[model samples]
Target: MLFLNRADAGRRLATRLTGFAGPDTIVLGLPRGGVPVALEVARALGAPLDVVVVRKLGSPLNPEYALGAIGAGGVRVVDTDAMRALGVTAREIDSTEVRERAELERRTVRFRGTRAELDLAGKTAIVVDDGIATGSTARAACLIVREMGASRIVLAVPVAPRDWIARIGGAADEFVCLETPAHFFAVGQWYADFTQTTDEEVSAALATTRVT
Candidate 1:
């Protein structure tokens, strides 16, 4: 089974999420990729949309493997063990957090424009992403939303490794991932047209969500 892209993956994921929609429910996208998927889910659910900004605090060298992630309002979630494995100093982590914090603010200004953020407190919030590789970013997002007082959190990802899903267990009130295969090669592997989700596409999806 393969997906066309984020939008197609989203529509499919939305079916599973039908059980979670209501007046007190909302959809939050992890942007630069998750926006398109979240937009479709928001449209299907008739819920308000917002971005939960979380940028990975990467290793000093690789930078792809996330050592942690920084979210809105100066909140940071770290993987202390990962840091130790990489021999990352506290100073390095602090520096990366500062940089990621700035990126989060920039994305907020770009994606939000002048719109006020939706209050997520006491809501059944579904935090979404294209897929999970390391799951660090998603885990961080879950924590940040919890801080916002979300009544229950449902993490909706199109695909993720079973182990990654297990790692995030109970962080969300109910976790909904469409696929968790053993091979778990990559998100692209399960997709037929897993093209890059560009920033322009993300912005357009966000615009559509605003008035939907």
Candidate 2:
């Protein structure tokens, strides 16, 4: 609970990531809420900025609970423990994934009208998000970039629980976070001015900046 807004959070996180600045560094921003924060980091790091889409495969019983996540072009991540604990069947998981895949396609169209995915091969990629609540979506993003052959992947976020952050520490080559408090709540609670990011806002952020 240390940030006033997404912009402020990005600046603080960017400061901590100063060591990784270089020509081959690529910034991949998760859209919806993460774009604003990612914009700041991309600017500060002087790296290429791009968006990586990941849709949540919500549980059939509790739609809000993310049992897994799916990335564009069909990459997927499922929490096997959660699925078993909730008694989620393969059919349900498949159905949810289908729905999320369509949603991810829609987002891709909205965010990138005619733009293509940034080249990540042989580059040091920094994946950015506003914060980590479940970390499922962020993890999915990291996997997608890694598949694209990023030399090193750094998962960066403004705030997250220490436990969740530790879980992802080994997944990425580097992990940069500003606040990892024990009293973790929703990512919004940590921000004084957390707001829903609109499709228009996402498009505008990408259009105005030359990072990508």
Candidate 3:
């Protein structure tokens, strides 16, 4: 199924997640693209929305290839097999992580400013993203939320590969996806307008939700 944009995808994804709507449930979006999609879900569910800042640790050789991911509260998910196969050393991984961690901090500050992070203690956290590709960032987000004391975790996305569950099934208690296309190539391929979401757009989305 092709989506007009992230908003369209989020509305579709929210339909699959009606069971999660409640006071105890909170929606966390992976910025900056995920925020738009998640905003729609939050509106539909009447759940508080927040950002789960995570960064993809790209391989040293091929920057597009993810070696792992890092999230808030020092949560990290490294792919040992991928590192060994790519001949990536510990030093290389450390360097990559350092770079990503800095960006993650910057984004957190930019998006959240001085606001305290949402208290996830004993609450149900629904992690939302526009789509899943490598699934590394989504996994890291789940771990971060779990660390924050969420009682239950749900990973929701609009689209993913048919084998996506196998890739990220262990991260959350429940997984809700709108589409798992068999011939999936990339997340952007399924969207008519896959425009890059900006920091301002993310901030605006958060600001609007904070008041409502």
RMSD of each: 2.5, 2.5, 2.4
lDDT by residue for model 2 over 1-212, one digit each (tens)? 56888889988889988888999987888998998998889889987678888777888987867777777666777778989999999889999888888989999989977887778889999999999987877876786788778989999998888887665645577788888888987899988999888889888878766453
Which stretch of 10 consecutive residues in model 2 shows the poorest summed lDDT? Answer: 164-173
Candidate 3 weakest ten by summed lDDT: 203-212
Give the candidate number with the greatest TM-score.
3
Give stretches of model 3 more than 4 Å off: 58-68, 76-92
Candidate that scores best on lDDT = 3
| lDDT values, one for every candidate | 0.83, 0.83, 0.88
Q: Give candidate 1's error at residue 33 in angstroms.
A: 1.7
What are the models' TM-scores?
A: 0.87, 0.86, 0.87
Model 1, residue 179: what's the lDDT?
A: 88
Winner of 1 and 2 under TM-score: 1
**lDDT (10s digit) by residue, model 3, range 35-61:** 999999999999989999978778887
Give the C-alpha lDDT of model 2: 0.83
Better of 1 and 3 by TM-score: 3
Q: lDDT of candidate 3 vs native?
A: 0.88
- Badly placed stretches (over 4 Å) of model 1 are 59-67, 79-90
